[model samples]
Target: MNSLALKGNPGDGERMAIMSGRHQAFGLWGLLLLIVMAHGCAPGGSTEVGPRAPVPPVSAVGLAPDEPLRVVATTSIVADVVRNVGGDAIALTQLMPLGADPHAFESTPQDAGVISDAHVVFINGVGLEVFMDRLLASAGGNTPVVTVSDGIRLLAFAGEHADDEALADEDHGEDDPHVWFDPNNVKVWVANIESALSELDPDRATTYRENAQAYLAELDALDGWIREAVTVIPEDRRGLVIDHSVFTYFAHAYGFEQVGTITTGGSTLSQPSAREMAALQEAIVDHGVRAIFVSTTVNPRMAEQLARDTGIQVVPIYTGSLSDASGPAGTYLAFMRYDVGRIVEALR
Candidate 1:
């Protein structure tokens, strides 16, 4: 995976240059000079200058001439929702592929071109896409970035999650990016997407609003369905064992407690230490967790091993990304229903 970590490393200066959004051109001669002079000073002596494409500024509302609004969504989950709101008025591109972990996602050079071409880029944000800065810099850093998770109150990592090893190297502070797990929060996303699209192309404001309204209704229904579905699991049995803290919003909204996590934190990038694993296994047993809910994006080997040791089932749940159109959990609505059904079955 060609990813740029947000840490104080030797390559930090070079990465900073890419992120600075300079219109300077590093011609062949300049690239060679940098390679020769900054060999040991610059990290890895990278001479690759990003595309300095000039992005056109967005006009005020009502710029809709004929071409559909070009939009980019960072994750498949975000793409699905953006599609719901954009409907036929926008040309949408999804950045992440199916079942890809957002935390550890690799950004390709082609992605930079895609983002540069977009009128606006929609992301889950709140620090979910760690590689976004590099990708945006590579794209020339001119596209307007919209965070759909805005307006929703984000949660902070508490107790053991506050000290997660995955976050030790990150100054991510305490905003949980997994707000989509709660349908109520998704309603906020619908509003934000609608607002962005309407502001960009006011000619189709009514269409965007209608699409948002319909999707908002569907989201409300999903919320109610989840509320009813989780009731099948008795209150005491609502303790959940997950691979990570991805379901913090789900548990908080649905009355389930995350009894233990295999990865020991909110990110799949973190590995569990032996002592942490032992403690989690003990918690699972003590809490009487029936199943270990593993995300389809992350490796299930650790989850499977833990389940074996505890004699519990490993249930796969969609997180970060969605399945293809042909599979279960293909749409955002279907994803919630499928996960809730699995959770209900496992604990009921």
Candidate 2:
């Protein structure tokens, strides 16, 4: 697809220039595999998924004779986080395949088996999961379920004229589900993950503790690094006007305020009305916003048009899922880093 470059302010070119150095998605995935290796063994014991995986949807999970704990996570992001804590003792099934969108993912029969047989299910709850209710009902499991983001302090989508209870849209909620975007908020998720995984597999409590501790230290460093990086933007310039409410968590965690979103509600599936678009356009001019951060999971054409109409630059970033383990936003940590780098570089 040929991209029509939208020109904005002159200095904006420098930011877009650096963004142009984007890694090829496949190549970045190769580098991502290496990074995961340093973090120690991935969860679910083995990397070798069977030649023909016979994952059933939700059914009655019977006893496994000396089998590992069966755990299922909703997305690769949740899977990666659980893998860190579960380490080698858990058999985890990720419902959504790599590079899939969590917001609008449809559950399948195999997914039923994953949820059915799992001793526990983990989800990034905060209304982030649109398929949770149906997936749970489909799974038909008796497993104790846990929401990793349940206990974390949450921020409301800070759009003045935005509705907080817009449930009609599927992909997003009034609350931002991208808490994992902020490493600190993820630390809260880790605490919940460690507790849930440990309760299921007490024998490996030490491993979970060790993994969680190490991961937390990295998160601590991540928080520090984000602050340092964000400082690149002058204090007064730290405001955001985004394609959707996707960056609400990131902006809140960092020091930026989300002045407005293109979509009137939390969901990306909802299109912006002409009236809403007009309002957003005005906000862009008022805020002196340099660029609009758009999610690659959804279509960026709307944002592109907004950029063209206003001469405000639009920069693409990974929000919902990591790039295929070979791209810039492959891992959770790297995904946040990549996004933050792009946001800071452009806004600063």
Candidate 3:
């Protein structure tokens, strides 16, 4: 009966304390079966998927009038977006704690309880929540799960090494899941969130649309700011090497080349082997990469070691999670601004 407690900000109208219980073996088996089934039905079943039509807005016939719509978001970033759109109209709960890694987050019984009582569960949903299947099964509910990344075109893993071909293919043979690296993709997320929330609670439809529009304008300004900020770095110096492959979308949008990563594939859970490490170090030296960008959610030991070996600097950036309430990256907008400033400074 292991217990996990996550503290929320009282000022933000968030739950102050959440208690989650460990899952039993039966639930684990059910989760595994669900994953297997999803994998079997996936297009190409470990290969790239072609472009598809944009995800249609979700519509609801009616809403419960007893109280606000009970909404659950899997990650803080997702929760923040929902908060912006839903405002004071919805009862939203974020599942993951501050700075928790979504890729490796294991759900407890309390998390299940929260999910079971929710009207809708929102997730980043490009394989970002690796434990989501188990969490949903443990919760045992028919709550609609909404994926915020539904409409964006996904990027595949880049620069695969010969030694890591199998691992890369097995782990990330499909599109990369870190779409939020580009602010434009987040615009898509906002649209999805606004539509979902409006549908669930139709009475607040006007408010949701208004809030979403305001946020979209902010996102537009953010995209412009990133472009201007990136112009400080020279074209040749715009090479990025990070802890993991998290910047594909960012690089694509900003005209930077992804030199390499400390860990292979998209997920931080995958480890870099000796040969892979050696290869990355060599590439860094060859490309004259100035610094290695690491995520706050992941351990910096390996990145630090690589920096020591190559005589480069190690800069920590927020990746999978946001910072604590008082930190620099407490919000998604702040997170991107801080990270981009760090990246431009390091590269320039």
lDDT score, candidate 2: 0.65
> After aligning candidate 2 to the native by TM-score, how far in Å is the CA of 226 from where it should be?
0.5
lDDT of 3 by residue, 71-129 (tens): 99988988988898988888999999988877657778899999889878888877677
lDDT agreement with native, every candidate: 0.72, 0.65, 0.73
Superposed by TM-score, candidate 1 places the C-alpha of residue 239 at a distance from the truth, in angstroms, of 0.8
Name every residue pair that clashes in candidate 1. Answer: none
**lDDT digits (tens) for residues 158-259 of candidate 1:** 223444465555664555668899999999989878887887888888999999999999999999999988877888898888876777788889887877
Worst 10 residues of 1 by lDDT: 1-10
Measured against the true structure, the TM-scores of the candidates, in listed sequence, are 0.80, 0.77, 0.80
Better of 2 and 3 by TM-score: 3
Candidates ranked, most accurate by lDDT first: 3, 1, 2
Instruction: For each of the candidates, give the backbone clash count.
Output: 0, 11, 2
Model 3 root mean square deviation, Cα atoms: 12.5
Which residue pairs show collisions in model 3? 21-109, 21-110
Model 2 quality (TM-score) = 0.77
On the 0 to 100 scale, the lDDT of residue 313 in model 2 is: 85
How many clashing pairs does model 2 include?
Answer: 11
Better of 1 and 2 by TM-score: 1
